[model samples]
Target: MKKRLIGALLALTFCVPATAGDITPRLSPTPEQAQAAYLSAMFLSRYHYTVKPLDDALSEQIFERYLKALDPEHLFLTQADIDAFADTRKQLDDAILQGRLSIPFALFLRYEERTAERLGYARSLLAQNFDFSQNEHYPLDRSKAAWLKDDAEARDLWRKRVKNDWLRLRLAGKDAAAIRETLDKRYTRLLANSQKSKSDDVFQTFMNAYAGAIEPHTSYLGRGSAESFDIAMRLSLVGIGAVLQERDEYITIRELSPGGPAIRSGKLAVGDRIVAVGQGDGAPLTDVVGTRVEEVVKLIRGTKDTPVVLDILPADAGPDGRHTLITLIRDKIRMEEQAAKKSVLPAGDGRRIGVITLPTFYEDFEGRRRGDKDYRSASRDVARLIDELKQDKVDGLILDLRNNGGGSLREAVDLTGLFIDTGPVVQQRRADGKINVESDSKAGAAWDGPMAVMINRGSASASEILAAALQDHGRALIVGEPSFGKGTVQSLINLDQVARSDTPKLGELKVTVAQFFRVNGGTTQLKGVTPDIRFPSAFEGDEFGETRFDNALPWRQIDPATYRPANEIRAILPELTSRHATRANQDKAFANLREDVAELIKLKEKRNLSLQEAERKREKDSREARLRTRAEADGTAGPGDDGLQSSERSLSAELAAEKAFKARKDVLLEETARIVGDEVSLLAGSKRLAVGN
Candidate 1:
């Protein structure tokens, strides 16, 4: 099945236009196309200086790719336009071939006009009650929303959003009069920026959509902005350790890094809206409503120990608004916290267990590029860790690959070899119908112990490969939530090679090139790998998985490859499962987890704001009641201890619960160790019996 999938993907590479039956017909270049190309050339000329001689051919290709990305369904361009663009395409190609130094400015104006027109249309659509709050805590049903039914209402909403955006630009210090005066000049400069940025954005978007279409693991990162580049290179950012997304006019926290200031503060919740920001006490709050995401990010981020205050609009806040001012001290992000870490668990049965938490399969590419031998690579480090664990005489190993977004294909294959003996790890199929089998070439396994893999919706790409391969080969039992289904391959193509100019310049392009399949013939595209024993995880919402994607490839299976099981680990599967079930059923930690999930769900359901005076009071009362309930449930106070009051007892209990939870996880490790020990003993017994007979 893996081979077939690879073959199919490869076939797409060389497929002629004639063979792409029912595909939207290619349109000729429009005036917009010519302008877009010219802008791209200008951007490339300014920033990308390594590849001298920007040319028309390269620009034409970039334009065509950009157009295709913008209108993949072929709904925007007509056949006549396609034909009309032919000459322009050829002219661009010829100029690129000759390495032309100059491009006309008139082309940039057309590009600007087209882009603004398109953005205007998008802005107009955003006005209606399309419900930007779908992924927020109070998830809205667009069908039930009255605003969605009225086009006028929707357009008005978008217009207001646009107005707010302009206001934000002004706040960012853009002089209104100067902006008006330099509109043409800025557009001209932006045309060049846009051209360069278009190539970068289009390539990145395509990679994202393509990887997302294949599975969630595969992703593309074009050359980032100067700020982003600095962050990636340094593996650090100055901000509260959280990723934010815009839903409607509010900024919502999307991801929280472990041990980050936001997580440590215990104040800001995932669904809370950041409505305003202030520098310090007595500073007037700056309303950040409807701001561009990056601009907002800049305001929030700062150097370590510098404080930034946020006016948080809780998910359930009413119109009069119940907001909290949260001041967080910015700090340098710790890359080590984001990488894989190891822990040792001591079982009551005198067995030792090794647990490894893999946050992500991250690679410091810039570090690698600079020829750093000790630069972090997930697979290499993991393999070394496994060896160290074995040397420490650990009886079992639990690989926590939860929330791992894959990196480096080579690393994934190598990691798979650590668990399984020589076998095909994954199959890669290209667009030209070629299938390549990625395999583990190693001779021996690193840790042949009782092994289990923990996964969640965030586990993708190479993470999927390791989990799927282990499960398929019967090497490990998968636990926790289902893995993120993301099985695609991307290739980074340097556009500098094709540029047409003497001033070494051209951006890079990342294109989706293939799809990946596991050894058992299943593609973890839309439906991620289901765990052997499912456990509730942090990402329970619908928005985080591949199913949320509109164009994700459907999950399918092919013929399984021939491979022998390392050992009959399944013989003790029943006992292991029974033990786990018993432990979980009686586990207070598990019980608390369930309660937490329920409370979160309830909190997320609140939406409508109270407008009337009486209603506002009621709303406030209701919010207070909910908060009290939450405090009581999660607080440390316990029942009747003379020295400690109820509040103190609740705090003590909470602390105890955390300690117990960690202990319970260790118990789980011990149980796995016992299972592995039993298996090893049974094998020895059978061998002795056979010899005696």
Candidate 2:
């Protein structure tokens, strides 16, 4: 997840505390903070895989990153403010090495001042009536927009912004008085949150900026952030199963955990911005814009079986789009909920196709360590499922890994063992140029019939490894969109453990120390695995993978590992591709999928929104209607299904849910299955012809 430039004001004086109406002290770096900086510099320079020098060039990148992190939308800081800190760009290396951070802290304080100014101006604008009839458009995504030259330019932008905010509420059926009250409270809270920023926040923000400038995946986690990471790793977070990151003053959903309420509800999506949170049906919504991600998490977390209402700005909806209120019950997402499951679809000529949807490549590390015979592991589960499917007389299989953001690396290699006899699966290259090959030595195939591995943009890391290995060995036909290119591996280094100082606490630095490669030699870094049979993708390559990151590692190649092809799947590609294309064209569900993908692409490309009230309302209503129509056609719940929903289920309920999912019209899955069915028939024909010859 991309870290947000969170936290507001910095405190300068260490011993002083703020009283009511007193000027809050500016944030400054302490001796401990300086020690951390020096240590971080040493570790990153010496140990990071990329080995980038902490020189003037890197210092400049860090400077730019920090500035952008502070004001991503260019709403708070002006060009003057940037110019004032121009000289510090190249000098940051010296500052970091010497443990001096006054300039960085000063810049953060300037941002806080600007935020207060902008919010005050916005509040003042709420008192007056907006000319909503004007046809001017507001830029929705201003991350790449030019910085404001002066205060006048900033005010003009803020004026349009205030009008846009008001217009959105008015179109959402809120009264003028209610809109006014909400805006007032929102602005007040935003200002207060800015003032409430602590020294740790500033240190974290700057350190992350430094780390991110070197590599996109690297980050410095504070104590609280570290604890959250542990909670997420343990899957103990009792909340709406949504992974959020603060960006551009909004708490945006980055990913959804499988079997989580956020995903099960099907209302929330990646890139959606959560603007407000309500405790229950009767509680008032607390505004979350410009708030810290930690605080937002606290607001969303609740006891199991309790309801949480979220006011969200839909990802596909442009800036002027109406807010959607979705209610979901909090619950713990168990490993079983994301385990591999099997289904059988009958094909022509008694060719039954088995589909196994693997959410993530997971394993019970502790259970395995304890020598449990029946320990929960993706490979074991999949092997068992394959056995069951074989007994059901299935001729082919489809490994559905659409949204599996990979988990266990060992499981990936072990899972590969189920297909190939024995060979190297993947190779890892460390910072010192040492390459280690991870192989599956165990022999014998689990179910080596005609098979396909399905992946999408969200399929990453270990997913890419497994898919690439299969593709390399000709073991399975790869299908669907390109995988998420995330070949680099990161390890968290606790600063306190390695620090020379006796300081009680420091932070943790997650650094990319190695990169993994496919058995075929190429790394899935910037270039993910390309499918043998491609499908229409709603997400563009540059918008949704490693390529989206500014400083991600580049794809590289090495000497291919010695491994024999498992089958001659590539020889029959032309026939399979032709048949799949014909079937996709004739399939109504596939056509609908293409149309929906095209619509989503268009929506994602929308950069501006009509500020005119009537025009905006028409657009929002039309979009909503189109979505509702699509949902109905796809056999999903429409806007009318916004009541409280829970995904927690009993054994019977789980079975029912699985049945319903299989019955649902998933165009992509259906098409993939048809492609596999075509392959099965084609291969069978080849075998018959061979026998006759």
Q: Which candidate has the highest TM-score of all?
A: 2
Across residues 90-191, which tens digit of lDDT does each residue of candidate 1 receive? 454333223231221223233344455434554444333323222212122332233222334434433443333333233335555533333333333333
lDDT of each: 0.56, 0.80
Residues 507-534, candidate 2, lDDT per residue (tens digit)? 7888888999998889999889999999
Give each model a TM-score: 0.53, 0.74
> Which one is best on lDDT?
2
Model 1 TM-score (2 dp): 0.53
